[model samples]
Target: MQQPVRIAPSILSADFANLGAEVRAVDAAGADYIHIDVMDGHFVPNLTIGPMVVQALRPHSAKVFDVHLMISPVDNFVTAFAKAGADIITVHPEAGAHTHRTLQLIRSLGKKAGVALNPATPVSVLDYIMDDVDMILVMSVNPGFGGQSFINSQKDKIRAIRQRIDAVTAGTSRVIDLEVDGGINAEMAPVAISAGADVLVAGTATFQGGPEAYADNIRRLRGPLV
Candidate 1:
């Protein structure tokens, strides 16, 4: 049987001063994981939080830390982030030269390894590493920024990746999670989920309002049929 979709609220849009409070709110709201976007100015255009932030928030969060590393030289930092309490470390396919090795490193650290694909990146890039990963992140919009419009072209990509994962994992105990990130709001959540995304990452949708409303938005996004 297929598992129900999980909602991971990205804290990139939260008020930095009240980060711990924000995590607590999501926890109370029943968030499955706390998505942290780690951006280095080189790999992506913008820079965001890193391992230090993850470490600081660890004590406050009982949920998983789904750390999306949008940085170059991700291999050098994967262990640091994992040590800082990242439950899952998702590295971008466009981030660096060593893709498979990076995933291996994440696994060596005893954390779930995930590979993220940009909108233009083909699912074929995952051909060799699919079996090694625990999750595949499909970007619905360009990285480096939040609140961007969802790229409609991503629907087909999501479906294609889903098919690939299913085909490869058939009759095996291993299950790879299809995760959709960027521009994931209540309106678009269902479409992404319907395309076989088991995890939905939302930033603006969850942090735009106060905790109660944000939590409600999460519930609404996870509404039946999505």
Candidate 2:
């Protein structure tokens, strides 16, 4: 069954100086998950928030903190993020040498483990470790920065992963969320949804009109179905 589309407004584009208030605003505006992008300069060319910031933002809302770690040797930091209140921690396959071990660590921490697939990375990466994952993030643009144009090619990847997720769910009770990040706005949102993406990570689109327009932005991203 196709799940209803969910909007996860990325905090990368939120006001840096007032992250707490921004988180509160989005939560009040009806955001499903608080998407937090963590970047390391070595892995993604830009550096963003860390565990402390995540901890700070934790008190602002009761929403799930969907933390995406764009850092290499990712296993070393999974515990910290999980401790800091990340309900879902997403790691890229390229970030660590032992993807399966890394995922196991995240799960062991009592938090949901997610795998993020970059544009060049193949969907087959999930073949061996699908059972260990709770969510699959299909990046529609490169991971380093935000506000990039949507890469239309990724829709194919979304469909492929969607089929794979369905195959897994058919037998077991595993329900993996197919989330699409990068360049997610009102325009490309429906395109991703048609390809079977249930969750969207919107950065600039969610923060463009400031806190007041957050509800409308998220509604637009979710389309008429909501």
Candidate whose TM-score is highest = 2
- Tell me the tens digit of each residue's lDDT in model 2 across 1-226: 7779888999999999999999999999999999999998989999998999999899999999999999988988899999999999999999999999999999888999999999999998998999899999999998899989999899999999999999989966668999999889899999999999999999999999998899988889999777
1-226 per-residue lDDT for model 1 (tens digits):
3479999999998888999999999888888989999999988889988789899999997899999999887888988999999999999877768898889889988999999999999878987887789999998998999999899999999999888988888887887889999889989999998888999999899887788687688888897854
Could you list the CA RMSD of all candidates, in the order they appear? 1.1, 0.8
Candidate 2: Cα lDDT at 170: 94
Off by over 4 Å in 1: none
Q: What TM-score, over all chains together, does every model reach?
A: 0.97, 0.98
Count clashing pairs, candidate 1: 0
